[model samples]
Target chain A: MPKKHRLKRVFGAEERQHQTELLYNLTYAQSRRIGAVTVKITVEIADFKVTKDSDSVITTLNLGSCVGIALYDPNRKIAGLAHIMLPDSTNALDNSNPAKFADSALALMLQEMTKLGANKAALQAKIAGGAQMFFSPAGPASRIGQRNADTTSRLLRLYGIPILGQDVGLNYARTVELYSKDGSVVIKTAGRADKAI
Target chain B: MELFTLSDVHYEIMREIGNIGCGHAVSALSKMLNKKVGMKVPQVKLLEFGNVAGFVGGPENTIISIFIGISGEINGMILFLTEQPSARVLVNMVFGTPKNTELSFSEMELSAIQEIGNIMCSSYLSSFASLISKSISQSVPDMSIDMAGAILSVPAIEFGKIAEHVLFIESVFSTETDNVSGYFVLVPDLPSFKKIMSALGVD
Candidate 1:
């Protein structure tokens, strides 16, 4: 088991309780954040952020068929994110940006996460997005979302990273916020309750 | 993929195509609403696939969208978008739903709006098809109320897979009164874009 998931068990009850209290306190402030520093990964940008501070949150929006991945290293108290759009970059003729493909984005994000005191071997990932919005193009666009999800899963597995949770494949659009403190992924879909995956 | 470029003439042709197509659409809307609607000139441009949502409003703004997949001589997507309040007014006009309330639309209201969207898209397609002299048609309309980013991503991904850039036209639907307002977005595939440009003698 990853040491990050077992952090609460290893710590004493009082210390764990205190940490949970602090997190709970932050949660309320997170809702009505008057002055919080938020980094947003906009469409098509494969940006990664690593933070040791518990106060910062990383967010990505409009995840229709695109996938936003959150990887956390609990032992190092650091987290990273990548919003990848396409399943394969190898077939791309000119889109050379590493963040545009699952394979390349995962590779880049892992490198950056390790740079921030995260252990490559101890990383756990949570994913969201990859929905078939419409049954168009017969099979191409309709199936691309599933292919993106599969490609993402295949690459993550290839690196030996364990997936902690996922909320994917639906017609609704989603916006994702990854909390740095506990690596919780908050997914918001319109007219639907928020999910923490 | 070779970089797709549009010249000044090609750009103007696209704008005209947008104007003619959406003019028919808004006329259909005006007749439906029994209100005199006004519009701003269509804005046409080539955009990066990632930036398509920004063209609508933003990613997170909650809005109602109607999507139609166009395929005939040219292939692309046509989207009709409006804020919830605007949609409420439209629904009220169509289905006699109560106004100034927070109540969601009933199934009848949803289908009424869908039918309205179907008429508007058909008019838009017919106008453009006549102008280009191409046999253009549309798929069934898909309606949803969600984030703009999610809705726009359909065409963005379609265009992104083949090329990093896509061409879209943005047209505003509005009036002197605040009762009705919305946006009509057109995204044409690369081959169709080329075909139109070639038809207009813009090599």
Candidate 2:
């Protein structure tokens, strides 16, 4: 039922036989529905991706305790995506990677988008991820998911970017894709309905 | 004994620590399952947080995991992970194959596996703490059937702020029939490794 559990199912012998076909179909469905050609650029943890190609889709996956922020400029048809791990860099010992923290990650995304001819004044943000995957009692990680989502919001506000939609701080892993063609973000989680934010 | 750049001797020290900790945990697991278990030498490495899941499978790979967080003089998380087949084998051994569904694990079956994880994590931390003469305790074990990437990212996000690279050790435990094989991943916070080295009085 859950996407994670579905992954486990594919490991079984009975399902293993058809797993490849199913996965292929699923991936094929993500990009092509008939004649539409879509190119995917994935953003990993602490990494950011920006695209100006109208048919480009930037995606980030497996956001458990991490946050994925997507920025789009409708006028310029440019999208930037960043998958950040930590909530803040204020007390962090190392702040070398601008895309590693929620605060600085927003800055990096904005800069990259601007470099790609996106107007800072016309940017809209959408975010997903930051789910506390497991329950922990002795805590340094209890509410990190919420904290990360919250921090991403504060930083986006500071940049004067209005977040159009968000799906965050739940108990499921979320994969988000930002399509530059329409400046729309599609959120996918296993066992739940897909959402367009 | 730098955080990311540990000398071979330091690696040896960390490996020994892993061996000691895993030894006790597997022994406890053996007692619970009433079977003999063997463990591989823990694989120790300073790895990028993003690639940790790629070691087991991909970020999208589904895994059944039991997680426990450690706190006190040191901090970290211990993960007990296995594929669906291994989980089914382990659960079948204890619960007699979940009469209704052969494909999925029930809540009760999941709880049993969580108990195993709780025991293993407790033994591992207690054994290591006593060995180093330091005080440490663990939180309640939490169970999840999720993506390996999603499961492993919790610790990375927790520790990534302090260190870009994580010091992790993974050991595989296998039984005679090979039904109960499990992967145990221990991730200690960067600063805690230094404490461990100093407490052990090893360079």
Q: Model 1, stretches more than 4 Å misplaced?
A: A1-46, A52-55, A137-140, B1-4, B48-51, B97-100
Native interface contact recovery, model 2: 0.71
* Top lDDT model: 2
Candidate 2 lDDT for residue A31: 34
Instruction: State the local distance difference test value for candidate 1.
Output: 0.76
Q: Supply the TM-score of chain A against the true chain A for every candidate structure.
A: 0.76, 0.80
Please list all clashing residue pairs in model 2, or write none if there are none. none
lDDT of 1 at A96: 65
- Model 2's chain B TM-score? 0.92
Computed on C-alphas against the true complex, the DockQ of each candidate is 0.39, 0.55
Each model's Cα RMSD:
7.7, 7.5
Collision count for each candidate, in order: 0, 0
True contacts kept of each: 0.53, 0.71
User: Can you write out model 2's per-residue Cα lDDT over B1-203, one digit (the tens) per residue?
Assistant: 45756777778877887898889989998887788999888888777877878877788888888888888898888888888777777777776554433546678877887887788878888888998898887888888777788888887886687778766787788888756788878877777777888898865
